[model samples]
Target: MTRSRAGGGQKKIPTALNATYYAQRASAGLMITEATQVSSLSTAYPNTPGIFTSEQTTGWKLVTDAVHQQGGRIFLQLWHAGRVAHPLWHPEAATPVGPSAIAAQGQTFTPQGMQPYVTPRALEIAEIIEIVHQFRQGAENALLAGFDGVEIHGAFGYIIDQFLQDNANQRTDRHGGSLENRTRFLLEVVEAVTQVWGAQRVGIKLSPSNTYNGMADSNPVETFSYAIEALNSFDLAYVHLMETSEADLRHGGHKIPTSLFRPIYKGTLIVNGGYTKETATAALAENNADLVSFGNLFVANPDLPDRFRFNAPLNQPDSSTFYAAPCDDSTENCGFEKGYTDYSFFSQLEASSRAE
Candidate 1:
């Protein structure tokens, strides 16, 4: 699920209510929570969730309790929007921070308005260490919130991805330029979070070819391959990869099997993006990935794993409601009521005989 941005106009989904939503769909083998900010300044979009506040912690506890009651496993996705963030979202209206002062060349949706991306302040070495501490604390908060594990958001055009790419990280210090320096922040954050969650409870999400929000690595292949190799030392629980986007096709354009990196790393691999049931099965059969993560598909179909297993019809999510509005005060108030969320599951729409 998508996460809310920090200091956004929308109020956060109450934890007691989010628990109802997640608990209602506990059939999946695993459920990944919406993108959650590690720090207040890390907010990318308005209305996104955060791991920083005590209220947020107390709120997530409701979600975990509901999922656990139904024997479901859930992972919290820790995120930082980086250059995609707008100044208005910051508490002090401070400029966003990244590996460099480069701004994303796109629009960022914020509470105030759709703002143009602004050049961010490059982080200092000490600030980098403090950011790693934020991630560590976020991981600890996730455990306290009752999540089974935590997934570091190192993909898309987020802060970690920015630091991993040379084009975005033009610094000369120990944190930029070369491959080693470029990936330093990622390594530090991983190590810091791993120290709290342990190897088995920590997973990472990465998108090597993604060029979203003006992210372009001069040598993404070399950068990511080296990154995977480095991560081997941590023995992480899993590595989730969003394979092949518009950015990948433009740069290098090499479509390697998701399994290509499987042998290179020693951990469970989850492949996402443009995957079908057959494709997911093939990925598992070929040992390309240990698991598959479906975003839009799963968002609409709460019983996705069951639908796939039983060959049941899937629900088509209403694109309008994906990020349309906040959940209403009443748990029964569906997103569709506000012209936002709509999906007809097999159990609710198709013939009962065809339902699983």
Candidate 2:
């Protein structure tokens, strides 16, 4: 691990990012861009990137160019915090909306101090369509910015997940009730995004029993099983699963194995959550997962795949600077704050593996 200039411990910033950061870690089979929002209303933090604006798309061009320069394939993760959003961080501060009006239990970080969540206004059918359009536009923007593909952020108790969960969605519209009804919103979203990027260039992520932001499902197994089958109809790039642990599982819910859903889903299955190098390797070796996504490991060690292959030591992440705005301030729209974008991948790998 490199020494932090802060003296005793690692600095709260990820210096290894940038062109060199991706170049150093160019060995991964695929690299998914960090979770990026689809619109201004989707903002949830100080430095997280959004795909809604032209400037944001331009900023991401630099990133994809760098990864490609290093011979790596990258996909952009399209996200919307849903009810997890804080009003202070958005243009409509204190007015963030969700599927239902139920307020989340935890405090949300905002420009102001942590504040209690307010009940989100239920989205009307027309508004729901608008949201889908936003996602479609984001997918188009991603392609315009030169991303290989886009992953719909359906997991982690986000907006789409909220609509999927019975506890979070109490409406009586086409978007609420019955497993089919609840998952309708997400399916529609996938369809909309696919229209722009094609099913092969699009994917979806889901958490069967995640409780983040107070999300819950009456029957996650049935709910997700049904959802997975529906996802298969689209023939998406992959169905990324976030397996819930024993503690995270709710009552009346069944634990689902990635293998069990394999038959239902005819596409690639990428599994995530609490996965280590050994576990990731075993998942691939055992055919349990087609790909494994390392969250923090990828965050701290950009060259994580190579590090795992060669058993190189890894760098721990800096929790403080993770959300801290970069000095250059471009982070207001994109995650990168400084001229961090100016840095390029290692030149040696590029010269040898440059794409035709």
The numbered model that scores best in TM-score is 1
Q: Over 4 Å off in model 2, which ranges?
A: 1-24, 92-94, 245-257, 318-321, 325-356
| Residue range 318-338, candidate 1, lDDT tens digits | 666676443333343433232
Error of 2 at 321 (Å): 4.3
Q: Model 1, which residues run further than 4 Å from truth? A: 3-14, 246-257, 326-342, 348-356
* Clash tally for model 1: 7
Error of 1 at 218 (Å): 1.1
lDDT (CA) per prediction: 0.78, 0.72
User: Residue 141 of candidate 2: its Cα lDDT?
Assistant: 89
Q: What is the lDDT of residue 122 in candidate 1?
A: 89
Which pairs clash (backbone N, Cα, C closer than 3 Å) in model 1? 4-47, 4-48, 5-45, 5-46, 5-48, 321-340, 335-341
